[model samples]
Target: MLFRVDPASPVPLGDQIAACVRGAVAEGTAGPGDRLPPARELAGSLGVNMHTVLRGYQKLREEGLIELRRGRGAAVAGGASPGRARLARAARQVAEEGRALGMADEAILGLVRAALAAKGPPPLPGPGDGRP
Candidate 1:
């Protein structure tokens, strides 16, 4: 996968790494069973510290997007299916729109929560639901 981090951005290096990985997975450049570069190697290549790369990997692990092991490094964990990606994109759009309208963070989150409550349980998977 092509990884990049903007040292000039206000966002933390770790956060930038994590976001890049997420975007790659969402775009299918990386996918289930694909192993990520080792932390040390990636850090050396990206000109960042190993700790920063590890932190990004840890975040992905916590989010169930990737698995990290002592010797195995990190691997995509099949978490970013196309449907989930679509939902994530839609949520970002909603948040942006809410901000443009001058809504508070809590208000935007509450609006999402209300919509979830209004929708109730999601429909059960049918044929070709993308499960592997």
Candidate 2:
């Protein structure tokens, strides 16, 4: 799998790592039962701290996307079917919400595609949205 990090991005390093792993899983670059490189090794390769890699793995684990074992590192968990279904559900939810807000189908899809292209989670709404 190809992973790249942009030191200048506003997104956290760990999130960038997580996104790369997620992309790999979605694209079939990494298959079920495939063991990822050890966190330390991946950190070294990416020129980031070990904790960053571990954080990424932890996020994947939390999402039920990967299994982490002591000394064994991380491995892809479950079949791709589950992951695909989850993604589909998420996409459907987003589209439904966008339509409910009166956004056109094309606009909704464009936003989805843009978010996917971004490095991490979608940006939070600004002060006008009531966030601190």
Error of 1 at 29 (Å): 1.1
For candidate 1, write residues 1-132 as lDDT tens digits: 888789899878997898777787788888888999999999999999999999988877766778887878899886656455445546657977999999999999999886775597865546786632
TM-score of each: 0.71, 0.63
Cα error, residue 15 of model 2, in Å, equals 0.5
Model 1, runs deviating above 4 Å: 85-109, 121-132
What's the residue-level lDDT of 89 in candidate 2?
41
lDDT of 2 by residue, 1-132 (tens): 778899999868987887777778877788789888898999999999999999988977876778899977789887544466368446646866898899998899889776765655757656586532
Judge candidate 1 against the unseen true structure and give its global Cα lDDT, from 0 to 1: 0.81
In the predicted model 2, the residue pairs found to clash are none
Assess candidate 2 and give its lDDT.
Answer: 0.78
